[model samples]
Target: MSLTEILSNFHISETTEEIYKNTIKASEIETPIGKLIAVADDNFLYILIKLKSPDKVINTFNILQKELSSSIVIGSTKIITQLENELTEYFSGKLKSFTIPMRCLGTDFRQQSWNQLKKIAYGETMSYGELAVKLGRNVNHARAVGSAAGANPIIILVPCHRLTAQNGHLGGFSCGIDVKTWLLQHESKFKNK
Candidate 1:
């Protein structure tokens, strides 16, 4: 699928943004939840997604290879290795924050929203309305923020799962509601460990 198709699958429109180009390395890392395809360069981690939609996501690597003006190779980078270690520690309930350098390749709004997402403390969650307010927008923008959250490419590292619906519902996660629920539960169980 093309980037537009991927964004549409997330129920959001596409906005072009400038991103650095390079040979983006790719690898599949296993987690307690599932398998994740991590892509990055020497400078920054670009995209990371669980293989929920393997065909679409795998094709994304190809699409990104073109869009990024780079080649996608089946290997890993230093950033990817660091991310894998962090993820292992995260699932083990020993890591509360991520230290990996993440690059957001999206619109200004989406980037801002993702930055706000990165602020959500590990094991903590908030409503979309709260996140909107943090972004200096009113509750009305909650839906927009939610859409941006849904389109978050980095998944757990970006912490999009921390945003809930207005009524505290586990509304949606690109990885599946089950994965979202499991993440929240895992965090809750080990937050103070």
Candidate 2:
């Protein structure tokens, strides 16, 4: 399917932001959970979705799509292939870190927040308040951190699923709490190995 069609299929609205028509490459690969949709430029993998539902996919795509000025083609690149391989290893519990080149788009704080999310170790989690303090923000910024976490485009590679509530509650995950729970459990299996 075409990029626009794919977006529409997921119930994403046509964005008012400039749509880049020819430079984006995307691919759909089936995974243990469901289909994963990935998009990338020549040098950076920009979007990766675990495909829980249209809402999360649309939210993530909209954030990354705004910066691209070309149409998204369904094909694989060296970067895409590497990402697929890494994801395979990850789901199989053999990979602990992702080495694929990636880029994120968002405001400065949001970008900083996503970058910090990448530092959360597999099978470990921290409250949003802890993340805010880690980011050098006062505790009040926890909500802002949560917002940025919600907007993370790179999903598992960046590990936004590792952020939780101060009381140890799984706050909210763009994909769904069940997926978040599964990811944490999956990572925990390999944590002490």
Candidate 3:
């Protein structure tokens, strides 16, 4: 068979096996609340979601693998090790901010919104409307800000849980409302320390 014919018969799996060989290291990290599955490489820490169930794990991997055009394997890297240490300090309230590099993947609007999330102080909270104005949008854009916050993948490091409703209700979290509550309370306890 000619090379053209051979290339035509190539399957995605076969292509994936040969060409997209970038290795993304992942690890299941334990936290006081639950397990967190973190994906990272030498340069950037990608997704660090609170572990849910078996199905969710597979689904998360599938989505990220396709986007990165790389294989996610069970292992550790310098970044993951750093993240583990930082998380430990954070949970104990010793660390107020994260210095670990993160690569956020999303639309331009979402990127802008998530960046704003990083500026929220450890114990302080911002309302969706306040965030929208910071993004140069009117109060009506609050819902859009909320959506971008919900899509944040780096969890506590990104600090989306620090956002609250105008009436003092905690907004949504990709993890869970309970997890969000815990994170907020935890930060409040250590804010002055």
Candidate 4:
């Protein structure tokens, strides 16, 4: 379906901001699994995942959407809705990995790095050196690979937090190290589950 149709179905509104033109939409629904809040941006969708109760998670997609311009288009699928559910659960100390399909715009190498990041299992971490090796590059190329990973616009969906320094030190994150820590901790909590 078209982005407008999807947004309309969910009762979402489109608007423009100083930085970008974007669309924001969300829905609260009762499901067999539980209650869920689904949020979508122009390029990505997020689900508010919960652990014990859905009350804890706030629907931030609209806030983000309102901040952007309306020129952006939202992708179609239930994936963003599911992701919102899973992310809600994750932040509340419940979920680990997400199953959402994400579309990232980037160059060939950046795309490769982002794809490699998805290979990182939940609760597992890999150093930039390791990622570079996986790409068949010298260890010194780790920095470049990390740069590519940092440029990943999809963040959690691509699992960039899974990449670290060789000594296991937390490195730079485009979204900030605190977010990276949260993602790591959240994933670690679900390691065995």
lDDT of each: 0.81, 0.81, 0.83, 0.61
lDDT of 4: 0.61
How many backbone collisions does model 2 have? 8
Ranking of all candidate structures by their lDDT, best first: 3, 1, 2, 4
Q: What's the distance in Å from true for residue 62, model 4?
A: 19
How high a TM-score does candidate 1 get?
0.85
Tell me the tens digit of each residue's lDDT in model 4 across 1-193. Answer: 3223444443433333344534445545443334434445534554332212222232233333444433223443456656657766766656665766555556788878888898998788999989988888888999999889766655566778789999879988765677678778766777787
> Over the stretch 14-129, how does candidate 3's per-residue lDDT look in tens digits?
65768677988878898987888888999999888876544555555666677888776678899999999999999988999899999877889999999999999999899999
Candidate 2, overall lDDT? Answer: 0.81
Q: In candidate 2, which residue pairs clash?
A: 20-69, 20-70, 20-71, 21-69, 21-70, 21-71, 22-70, 22-71
TM-score of model number 4 = 0.61
lDDT of 3: 0.83
Would you list the rank order by TM-score, best first? 3, 2, 1, 4
Show model 3 residue runs off by greater than 4 Å: 1-12, 53-60
How far residue 51's Cα lies from its native spot in candidate 2, in Å, is: 2.8
Q: Which portions of model 4 miss their true places by more than 4 Å?
A: 1-70, 73-79
Candidate 4, residue 120: Cα displacement in angstroms equals 0.7
In order of appearance, the predictions have TM-scores of: 0.85, 0.86, 0.88, 0.61
Backbone-clash count (model 1):
0
Residue-level lDDT of model 2, residues 105-168, one tens digit each, is: 7899988998889999988999999999999999889899999998777889989999989988
Give the top-scoring candidate (TM-score): 3
